[model samples]
Target chain A: MKQTQALNLQQKTIKALGVNTSDAKVSLSYLSVAFLTLLIGGILGLVQGLERAGLMELPPWINYYQVLTAHGILLLLVFSTTFTIGYQYANLSHALGGLLPKVRKFAWTGFILMVIGVVLAVTMVVLNEASVLYTFYPPLAAHPVFYIGLVFVVLGIFACCIGVFINYRHWRKNHPGQTTPLLAFFAMGVFVLWFFASIGVTVEVLTLIPWSMGIVETTNVMVGRTLFWWFGHSLVNIWYLVATSAWYVIVPKIIGGRHFNEKLIRLVVILLVILNIPGGFHHQIIDPGISESIKFLHVFMSLSIAVPSLMTAFAMFAVLERAGRRKGGKGLLGWIGKLPWGDVRFLAPMIAMIAFIPGGAGGIVNTSNQMNQVIHNTLWVVGHFHVTVGMSVVMTFFGICYWLIPYLAKRKLTPQMNRLGVIQTIIWTVGMILMAGSQHLAGLLGDPRRTSYTTYGDHPTALSWVPYEYVMGIGATLLLLGVIIQVYAVINMMFFAPKGKTAFPVSEPEDGAPSAPMWTERWGLWVVLLLMVVAMAYVVPIVDMIVNAPPGSPPIRTW
Target chain B: MKQFLYGLVLYLFLLLPPVAALLESIMIIHMHMQMPLLILSGFLMARLIQLKFPDFFRKWNSNGVPGIMLFSIILVYWMIPRTMDEALTIEASELFKFISLPFLAGVPLRDSWKKISSAGKNSVFIIFIILFSLMGWLYIAADEQICNNYLRVDQITLGWGYVTMAVCMAIYVIQLIFGDHSEYK
Candidate 1:
């Protein structure tokens, strides 16, 4: 105990005042929920993996799509959405002088509502009373409560945007002259984009709830589809934004250089936000009700957005290369050798980026107007995003959180935290690769994407994809173990990382390159709100086509 | 007479998808309006989203704000078909049905915008994607409406979706070959 105290004493800094921010309270809470959500997602992932192979009898978790669905919704929608936002909020609060009341309250409320919504959604699905999974694409409807729960979840998401807006306002107000933290700017841009992005869905949900509840007898199907796709397609964009912000802020710092082309990054954010809304008609590829011209337009737009991504990739790597050479790395490629491999910040994101090859492949297949027949709703698609979003975004998020927690808490994390990072990252990498790979193969074998029953004890034909499914099961198991290890590390740090570490006051960053508030109060508010109007404007016509398509008119095919 | 016959056959091919995918879409949308339609459309749109949402000609936005907007739009659009009513005139709908033209910038993968922007590295791959879309249009304009309708979804070609996917993959491959941010370059 005495020795522990001495080590603990070494970690504390009493003379310097800690930064004043709400990051601690809010981030910790968000992590608590997200951590649980991650573990649950991992467990269900394991079950889904095994079940895909028809290996339920070998493990209780097989035959668990209900569990898997619950996991995806919670992790993808509830956890990733809020956890990353919480981190952004905390970082912004510190970057600015203090928190905004409107934003803070709204964020907290959103967190609680998200928790409640998750409970409602997971509970109903767990009972097998409702197993629609993360997507509520109608004809395969779940209980009304499931839809209601999701709407509440969306409300929580809206609240998070409000918080993001406030953070932006706080940044601008406190540091009038400073450029927004690249991360903060990116965060604000995405949040603002989301604020507008969410409106279409809000309209859909507002319209859907009453109609879904049977309030209107002849509700327009066109309106619902137009609105839903507008929101649905953009949500993936939100994930991209988060991933980009992580890359810009975290990746550069790890490589030991400040961002060079900040303006382009900012422009990328803006272009991505605005351009995303006009291109949502991609989902209607196979549908006959809408115009082919619209599909063509969306397809072109879909392909067009790849420009900024390539630009960012090139710019970021250029900086990274410079950083490597500056650090005395030899030869053209010797800089790669000098990079910090063990560092979570350096290693995790690299893995995430590498995994995207298949991810991109899956995206192209799914988004193409014609190629959908070869692999629509297949396991291949599921595997694709798991690599792109889950590994690239979620894993990098974990890395960022691990890197930032010590700074936020104003103390060193247990060295064990570093060890856990290595372990979890490896697990995430291997597990994701295996799991995603298996799912792709399974989809090829015609294994259904959201089925509740794929695990039979005696029959292999019923589970045609059983051979491929086992690989996924094993992947899930590894992820579960990895997440559990991480949770324990968090617990140990929160509760038992010696004394005096927990209560240490927060401190502003001392990089001394002229620090300023993270965001502008007015800009984020105006931008997101303005975009919301645009979202509605953009979505209205699409909906109109669906609702008023002259019924039974055979779409006037002149060919 | 020859031109009219050719146009008539093309129109017939185009009409099948709008009828099938549209009816399915309608079933999904109508069901949300109440339970009766839900039974049919729920089964149908689920099939479509799984079967169709990833169409290469479809739009994408798996990036930041665009992604959020794109995702939310899907949920919102699915709720009220009437929201779309104001956007389309009866004549426009007929014109849409009569002539098999691409929608939303001429491809199904408009959603790729968000993804490209979000991925931060997929940008270089976009150039190839544009070329692919152009080539697809050229091919369609020339001839080959055969499997086009078999892949014909509602009014869109299922084959088009596959081609668009191929384009995206091709770009990805090109990026993989040349666009590595690694110091190895």
Candidate 2:
């Protein structure tokens, strides 16, 4: 009994002292890399957009494809991965009281490995040795060094995953019969998805290494494409899962409300983990070699993700409505008006959540068998991801920075900084609407993606897309401005904001809410289920691709 | 009652010609997916039966040994490639498969599971693991098609499916051995 009280007191002291300095340093370093990548990637995006709009010309040394490749890799892969790690690690440390010593070492090892990997990859891109774009789909082969660098990135991710698993297991052992803190649970979900999602891409990259080196005469293009999507699609959800973690836990506290039912949250996490990897097939809907029946089954698998997403939408509204009503707001729609609209911490993710309604609908269009053929290689697909990833996921990450950076740096978010964040959020939302909305319209009008500026002798249909392209260029410029302000806000909060303690806003469960079930903690079972689902989804089509082999293709350089 | 209704709905859905044809068209799906789903439906439906005839279960399978034995025999009978071929070709065998797998195998397995000792449960997993490994090896290494209904490539796919299933079961057993469940529970 005395030991229990002492332990509780010790934990309270740790919480009062704020995030541990060593842990804060690790998270802050990762955040710095993430924002730095965003700055560079944002610049590249502006260049590409203006060039695509026929407003700018690239010099002989630099090309549009190289800029596009770097933009995709830096923003999509590096920025998201680094920010998730930094933010999730901070959550783990704050929630678990502190990370295990070896876990901290593992985190540093991962950071170093990832940094080295990124440097190698970006150098290859800059030197024009590899401009295969982010997907790296063969017969457009990259330098063997680029693929090897990707191997390093996957290995680095594995290091972080192992660290999280070890820490989770240690906590479970120490606290018998007690559920982990909600944020720590979210951390576990994020890393579990990360570990599994990377497997398919790792396999693809390993094969490409041999093929790219001419060690193998040719590679199976269909298998390569299939494997890439398996990883590619899951990467989308990893970001979604990370964003939803903030929505479910952090946002509620920011709005002064208890979180929704704990069981539903855990269930959403589990469902997302299990149903995620197979959804990658929808990305390959128009790709050949897979039979129609298998594609039909895959369509079902892909749509299964909507179930959890809808559940999340329902839960978020419930939390907001309840919180608003408690503050004396009346009537059915009046609660919407009562939310913290002025707070950047709430406003950014609030708009992010709103963006997902359209974003998710666009996804369904892409997943459909017929609709995919209509916009297969069009900018509509590009527009879909930009809204989904750019607004829905990245904006949430932006909101998190408002509080997260300050908490990690032991600083207060001054009102001026908060006001700047609100402005940045507004600019970002407006920019994305103009950019992604026009991209969708142009895509429907037959504009292709990943292609340099071409007028096709001033063809009428081709000329029709020019106006949308210009709007995209203008929107891209606005977005770059937003990115600059965001980076500034992050830096200001991290180093220059007034020094004081800030709370990590993990919310409590509502009064009378039942505890999450013990079965939800059985991660081993969840993993086995995940493996079984993957096996079921992949075995048929993959086997057919291998057994009925076509003549494989040698490397081709399109540029 | 809810379980029974869910089971009935699943069973009826599986009975649909298009659904069954689509699932059975792929050899691995026929065995691994369709067969397991049939068993799941029966497992769920068994709750109603257990409630309806508690005395029947108590008297015939008091220790769960008899029920488990019945399940093992029926499951083994279905795993034979010749049996799968026969069910596709001969309508009588098909009827027997539909009847025997659910009523004899799945229902009895569900009743037997909780009543069995932990060691007995482990033994069941061990048996399946060995069976799956042998099946995987036989199907993968065979020169000729193992089943007349399935193409050689389909047989190979089923072989890989068996191999993956065995790997999954092995992982489960290993975790069961090493994991200290009391820590979390």
Candidate 3:
């Protein structure tokens, strides 16, 4: 009878979230698309780097801004979102015990829409019809289709988020009184935050559609800009949350650590949900019409949101210490040596965290009302985000993909592939250090971001930036190499590798499940608080703006 | 369906340059009309879209984050003085205000907030309180015209309005904090 029961459990586990093979296919498709896009984005990055170095002559068809925009859109938005969604879906479904109703459909629909949207947007971008850069600030208008395609992509994400929500609800129903699985909790937190945060972009996109299509004769450059930042800042948090989720749930287990305090982790996620949305106001510190007092308040709120990140930092290190010490290592710092330095999964996120220290610190300066004036549009700001989003989040995603692709493909990671993964992480980390370091240095010298470097026709002072740009260009080349390796490795694992099951490792807490207050799972309260925080940050300032009107600017294309 | 179309029509009417400028010429209507209408129109569009794509709506926004966030953005955008200035002066800007508000802000929010938790509602209140207070302080402190169209006195009055609303919000928050007496067993 015991044997029979064990067999039954194995059968259920094989199905893993009742959705069956179709779910795996959906996940794989997303992963594939993500990597494919990464390949193209990586090549663009290489070209941009070389172009900055003055190493290559530009093709007649390929403009700097156009390539830059494609690079940003594809890698930053497309690659990150698709990879995160795919990985999270697989994890959430497995943890939740099955796919909930309509999830398969949602995933497929989202994927298809995303693909179509990417095609529309990228085509126009390649044609140089939309060269407004990824931030796409207007009076720099893109082709109408660019905005429209973005709308579809956002809607696609919306659909996927819905599926996750449904699965969460279903899981709750099925397991009354049980603690929500940590992975699912993390995924849900990200989805929830993203749902609200995306509104900024949605508004921007909707407004752009009519303006670009000539339905609206003029656009309010300031409003469009403000809306972009609103969306823009939230998008950063979304990336952070994605990477953090992996840290909270996956990293501990992989490092042989028991779960960091689960309730504390939950609370951290909750705090992030509420606090992350309004922090976007900090980005507008240099922008006009917003009051000094409000900007100051945003500064405070921005600092407030940093609390969770701080908490996460503590929680992560504490988990590492516990796991390290438990493996018969002595002394306060001695356990560091005991960690799995070999596995790419551990090394990648660890590297990401190390990068985040400076990245996060730079963020505080970026948010500082007075200090922000110094670096508002400088390459220092560029370095800050690249370190934060580029190093931290992108690296974390790469870490997840190492094991995740193999698992989804029903294959064991070959030793060669594992070795390649480790090399990729190291190369990427080293490259980023070189790239971001130089950017920060150059930015301090008053070098602006988003401009192609040319030695001709500049003040003598401007010549200082050339050396740093050269370093950055070199860094970009190395990073491109890592990107190529990562793409190649993932493709091999997905298709050419041998088939077998890999563990979906989730660590258990050190002292078993500590009784967490049920309120830890109370998403309602958190959501409400989040909404309130967002409203307070945005409402009055926006209202004040509308009450007093300025002459609106018409859209103008520089290209 | 009727409501959706009506909302759209109303939205378009508000976008007309003369009508929009006339509304925006006043300090109160300009902020209240242009900003809230963006949300209202968005809410309406969300509702209409839901009728056609119930599955998508139910699956995605049933929890209210998407709708609430969308509405919040529109509300926030028009509140910026620059947005208002442009809407009043630029025909295209005014047109966008009309379409975006009702469709993006109004439509989605109407559906979303319904299923949202009371906690969510309370949070929205808190946001308003903080926003109003800051806005009030800024308006009151300003010696010069912040918006080109509005008088200095109007800015002061708006400041007062914000201060008053903020006070009310603070009181309400205090009340909720003191009033709720649920015991965990």
Candidate 4:
């Protein structure tokens, strides 16, 4: 035991903390839940895809809206959140030299809460008690149980967030005055964004409960919606930050490259924390009651969030190019082919980044006040998020899982699984090309989203959407098939594969910078600044909303 | 026994909402006010029951996992919008709510939470978080009225209430996690 302890200390700080076994279990549990959700969500996606193609008819009991809601909730919320927490737990423990035991307990609690919440909420959706789409905008009511279940989900995540903070604090005390590890810094950014961004939903929900319970006769639609968007926009940023973390930290290592300048990365993360929340105004650019000036200001703020992303692109490419050159690759762009294309880890994130180019560009278009009018609520917007969240975030997560499962399960990655992983990435990329591409094209043609175009009855405009919907249907089917293979590979690797340990690749920083800026670690200053930015973005409009608001609208049930 | 008195207090606390027409009259009040009170009361009642019948509590909830699971199950049942709606519209449902909150959910949770592993607590935390968000989505997204007494829009607004509570609870959990660490040192 003493010898092992000595060796652990010599190896890395994370192992010294002696929580890997438990951390592995914790992470695996979370990953399992995420994968489970993905499986269910993937099947749902295929069903919807087929439905869109007009090939398979959905029964009356399970309508398009119900399928759509399940698809969104399971994939976007359940899958992503569970995957993130699991990833965070695994990486954070290793990076930070191990978490406090107490923190780990909190993580477990959060996981249980999340599972129960998902089951309850999804049950309602399945039973048709809550046919409300994932957004759950007001004036639409579902079962109160659905709302309560959702509350548990949020709280469950909240508990996990708490675990993160606790562990962070414990680490800070143990290594006072030292800089936190790169991945931990990234995780911090995610949680901070989550905690801050959640305020929007919090405000929206608080108001909603009273109104739903009939405490109030009417609901102020503008207020509730504004608040929802506030949370909504930030939530996307949180997902972006997760993908960004992998891009900044893991991608470099996976490509045999060194880390980017740690100081700059930290600054970027901090900037994201402050800037991510205020950008919600971009989602509300076209909403009434908010002044045009305020909207324009938000437009600018929203544009600013892109700066870090741009920085990331520059930094990532530099790292990759450097790694390629070190491997004796010849020219500028030639280095790209030199990287490990066959490895699922490199391929998935790479394709995701490529997808982001268009996704990010689309975002810029969405942010522009006048331009948004052309494609707002269109298929284009749907395409944009799928590219960003679906392709970028979800794809990276899958790549992480490829390695993570083997590591956590203490199993070797079989040749079959490795081959499957590579194929999954390729299939995903191709599927997204067909799916998101057609969606973007259809969106540009003023095709509406979230509608069964084939069932348009006699609407002449529906003709334009039919072709794209068919293409999307084909793409979605391919994508879901890829998901099935991916899931199978993961399960096989975790349970059925031969036993062995895998290496966790953590790279060193390439930039030989002396010391990180002190201000980077000054969380207080950054938080204050974040609040300031938020106030600048929201204070005027909210005040105006309160002072000159119209009469509250009574609830209306369309269905 | 002092334990029984505590249980009595829990029962009284839970009964307050329905007796006063608080649970039935307002949608948010019923969900936010009455439901949580029920859980809290049940939590206290569990403690009392544990004290009064240590053997039974020990056998059922010594490790806390089983008891907590039971608590979670009961809580999940009560949280359904249908259950809440029924409680308001039907007399028997209200009585059940009163009984379930304190005796079934609250008491067991109180007993289980103490014995549950930290991992278990973490799971509990996540469950509540997801529940809150799910509720938020349901209330906000549903176009039709889930509750007879409430308008469809009001239901949507109520969804926001769950969202807000969940967020606040999350923030608090973070504080608790960090707060305990500092104190431990």
Candidate 5:
């Protein structure tokens, strides 16, 4: 027992002194894959944008849909998933004093599985055998290999989820009666949501596999769409939750202020976890095979998410104001001026949070049944995601990279790199505003999304949209440049930055603040409540879709 | 008192004509959502009642088994398809539903839950899981509409609801079995 205690003390000292080389290797590998995918996806995004604006034409072999599919899958699925795993695993290791050996094995296994899956899926897209787009909605079926690849991806996610869960349980067992570190808690929320969310899409993909293989003659289109959105919408919230983790934990430390009330933060995380999956119905507000009354009920359910979001917004402002006041700033808004605006770590996520104001408001507009009718399949919907995912989520991720990459690589964050990151953030922000803004305007003017550029025989209305399309092309060009700079900064930080130690920034709670309540630790209870809410939201409509399903659609390769 | 007031507000809101009609418009909402919410309201209100009539509960439910048995009976009676049909069509049956679910099942549940042993609580969960799975099978497999007011599809939906709830309870039970709460506590 004495030897075990001594060994544990030694281990803790080692962890506190520097990054564990093994754990750093795991995270750095994932980050490497994430940035590489970003580079490829960024190029594809520019190509698609330029093509849509009629500034460039694709060759005969590579169609617009093919490029679109590859871009969405690479950036949305591969890049984001890899980065999240990398970051969350690093958090787990830091907070829990390093992952169990088995958990690290799980991480590496997940990485291999995901890489294999991406290769298979991307090969299908590149060969033009699968151009169903990232949503992969039927009857536009992909190659059976594509669906098989997705299954592997889901399995990979499950591996990571299991790893996180095991590490959490081990920590809880050892600590006993203590609340988990805040970052670990957020990691748990992300993985739990990821696990449940993937279930719906996994089911969808499995059925699609058989159908695409001609083992099944046809598939239920409505059910397929419903299941896809069930996963798709929750995936957005998962990214949002990850961003908020950084906002709540890292940003406060960077700004030299304490985090907000622990209870309120935990409450927000809990509420988000319970309420997020049901909001998927709002994505289907305009889809058929659902009753008007049900859709109306779902509007309320979706809007329920706004409660926690408002709470977050309020908490963030309070923290900022309190921090600014401590710096001896006077007057009503002078406190804002006291903030470190020049710090890319603060600026990127700060702008991301600001973008959420419009992003969230636009979300409300989309959730409303009547409002959704006006912009359902338009470029406005595209614009909305660009603001939310691109600015709010991805920007936060970029900010994280500046510190996280250097910390893992045991390197100094050079001032030059910091300046470049700020520049990249500015360029990315301006590019997104220009691109997403024009998309919104064009959509309001009835410009459709997911369509190749067409003149409709040079109709006046079609010709009028050309200006907005050109702005989008220019914005895309700038965004690609921003991506290049970001990738370069990340590479330099990882390999070429001067060797040194960097601290992981996790903010303390306010002095004399009340401790988080024990009830928040009851994860089993929370899971049950989440399941009950999901059952309440999904059972009726899913049953209706299956029982009253239309004649199933056969697989079609539109591309 | 605050809990009682909130509960009263919930109970009154549930009693509102439009709210009642809207919830009952769908079969699963009527049986699963509305009924469970009524029980929750009563659960919330039970604190005030327990304070007021401490001896009344103590005398009859000292061992908790009596109160829990009453709760189980009330829940099982309501789970019957005929009871739901009658509650929809018959005035007295509907009134009984509004009275019995909250006052009978919900109140007793709150009173007994803490008093019961871990084994007793697990038994309750086990019983419910078994009962719900059986009901789910019956509802999903039935050739004819079991309830007059609800469609066959609605019945199947309700079956799935039962199955899902049962699954949730099963999970809770499994966690309880595996989770060493003593370590955390």
Candidate 6:
């Protein structure tokens, strides 16, 4: 008899969540696209480094603005975004106890739309017709194709989103009256948030796509910025929220031998779902027409998102304290010392949470209206965002991939990239710091983001920044070096890593419904909803200013 | 469908590094191209070579340490006299300006990461990333990188921007070297 009989579809939903894990045909395809995009983005970044320092010169086709515009759009919009949504489609739905109906058909459509969108966008950008910094901020505009490309990409995501929603909802309906699993809820929240987030940007793109192509006359810049931020701020936070969801469960399961305080975990989820929405206004701090009071409100809500983080941190620490005590750990922070030092899963989260400290620091500064001006539009802002967004969220994605490839693809990431999670975590953390720091300093000195050339005319008083740009370039080299190694490691894993095929049986929930604490079931839903309303109260007025600002008041100049 | 997505990403990836070089080559064909493209090509080549083969390439990735030890005699005796007069009172080049100034890998002494633990790991870099940004807050409090800053700070600045990124990243890498959050050990 076979070692294990293949379970019916229902059981496979939970235990065999990986849709195509065992099949080399499926896994390799996804990995190829993912790796290619990542590598391309990495090279573009290094090119930017060279440009900033005026190390090499080239054609208008490869100009700083052109490269940056392409790099910015491709990396965030096409690369990371695709991997994120795609991974969720292939893996998370089953992981969340849902079945993907018509999976093959769905994948075909999603993949097609995405490719078409990316190709069209790249073509337009390379043509020198549309070099708008990835933002839809106007009177600056791109060729109509850029907007059309974006529409297709968004449509693809919506396809994935619809599939995910249907599956999750079905899982809940069949399971009935059981509160939604935390991961499931988060996946759903991400879907809803993304759907909502796309709204403002979608409208802006629709309005501007025509004008950029000369299909229409002038459109309002203030309105455009406001709408884009409505999408932008929330968009980044959605990444934060999604990444953190895995953290809460992954960390405890790593250290606790059993899971941690359920009520606390539930509270964090509810807090995140609510706290994330209102903070988008922070992106508009210095923009004219946004009310001062409204900006303050967004900042407050942004900070409020920190509550769940703090709560999770404390609870996570408590779990660590228990584990440490069990192992006889005793010292200032000896508990951390005693945990499994070699286990990649446990170690990855430790590195992630530790990095979260800096990620959090940048978050606070970014939302501050007055402080934003000091660092706004400089490398500092870029550094702040990349670290928070890059290290915190992206690292989570990396960590999960490290853990998942083995479980899903049945292969280990090896020559044993000894303590893979721990080592990469530390390297990435360092890279984020060095890169963000130099960028911050460069930005503070008035070096603009997305500029390919910094050694331009009559800015002699800023001679000091020239060296700083090189300093930053060196930092980027180090970061890119780490990334290159990581790419190699990921590739090695696909072909060479150890494989594990023994599957766990489909079982009851981690904690039965009754055992799941009471306050968790009761308060989480209400608190998140209430917080969402309060946050919107702040975001609404700021948006109103953008919506209402008369045609062209003229953006205030630094001089 | 999958092939299309695959082609676009791969093409773009392979296309970027060559962009500068390709742009430069355009001049050979057209007889006039931007000066920035020429300079950019050099940087791109260095970057591409470095990434493609960190340990293999001889001209670029030559072990600065061993290569230096072996070539020192030739460099000191022959090149010193030939270039000594020009080394001083030199002006920075406009296009290759980054070359004229000092490059700070901070002595390139090697071993930023201990044999036992790498300081350049993603994890430790993150913790330092936090402190590095807070450095600005600290500077604001002291009324310098601290004082007239905070919400009261004025202008979009390079000092805070680049320096904060540098300090944050530097501390993370350095901490990996100095601290023993050595997951492997």
Top DockQ hit = 2
Among all windows of 10 consecutive residues in model 2 chain A, the one with the lowest summed lDDT is A1-10
Q: Write the per-residue lDDT of candidate 1 for residues B80-107, one digit (tens) a residue.
A: 3342332133446434322212222112
Candidate 4 lDDT by residue in tens digits, B1-185: 55556757756755675554844565665776677776776665555566668998877667888777877887788778888878777899878877777777777777777677776787788889999899788877777777777765447546766776676556545644544333222
- Kindly give the number of clashing pairs for every candidate: 173, 0, 37, 75, 0, 77
Q: How would the candidate models be sorted by TM-score, starting from the highest?
A: 5, 2, 3, 4, 6, 1
Give a tens-digit lDDT track for model 2, residues A233-311.
Answer: 9999999999999999999999999899999999999999989999999988877788888999999999999999999
TM-score of chain A for the candidates in order shown: 0.84, 0.98, 0.96, 0.95, 0.98, 0.86
Q: Write the per-residue lDDT of candidate 4 for residues A122-174, one digit (tens) a residue.
A: 99999887777888877787676777778778888788888888777666655
Point out the higher-scoring one by lDDT: 2 or 6. 2
lDDT of each: 0.59, 0.92, 0.81, 0.78, 0.92, 0.57
Pull out the clashing pairs in model 2: none
Better of 1 and 2 by DockQ: 2
Better of 3 and 6 by lDDT: 3
Root-mean-square deviation of every model: 17.7, 1.6, 14.6, 18.7, 1.3, 27.5
lDDT of 1: 0.59
Residue B55, candidate 5: C-alpha displacement in angstroms? 1.4
CAPRI verdict on model 6?
A: incorrect
Q: What share of the true interface contacts does candidate 2 keep?
A: 0.72
**Per-residue lDDT of model 5, residues A1-559, tens digit only:** 5644753774677567678788889999999999999999999999999999999999997899999999999998999999999999998888878878899999999999999999999999998999989999899988999999999999999999999999898878777668899999999989988988899999999999999999999999988988888889999999999999999999999998999999999999999988888888888887867999889878998999999999999999999998999997799999999999989999999999999999999999999999999998899999999999999999999999989999999998998999999999999999999999999999989899998988789999999999999999999999999999999999999999999989999999999999888778777877898899889888989999999888999999766
lDDT of 3 by residue, A1-559 (tens): 5644553574496666333466678889999999999999989988987787677768887789899899999988999889888988988867866565488788888898899889999999989999988889888888999988999898898888888888787666545567788889989998988787788889989988888888888777767777787878888888898899889889998988787888899889899888887788887898888778778878998899789899999999898988889897798789999999999989999999988999999999999988889888888998898899889999998988878888878887888888899999999988999998998988888888887757658778788788888898899999999989998998898888898777787788777567667767766556666765766676657656655647666667898
- Better lDDT candidate (2, 3): 2
Candidate 6, residues A1-559, lDDT tens digits: the string is 1212232454574455543442323334555566677777777777888777777676654667777877777767776666566445544444544344454355556667877888888788788766776884677666678789988877776776676666664554354345556666566667666766776788878887777767576777776777787678778877776776666656555555444656566667666666666667677778776656557766787788888888877866776777676788888798777887676655655666777887787778877877788877777878877776667777776766665555456665553564655676667667767777778777877777766665567477456677877776776676677667667767766667776552311123345534454334332233335433433443345334433556552222110
Q: Which prediction has more favorable DockQ, 1 or 3?
A: 3
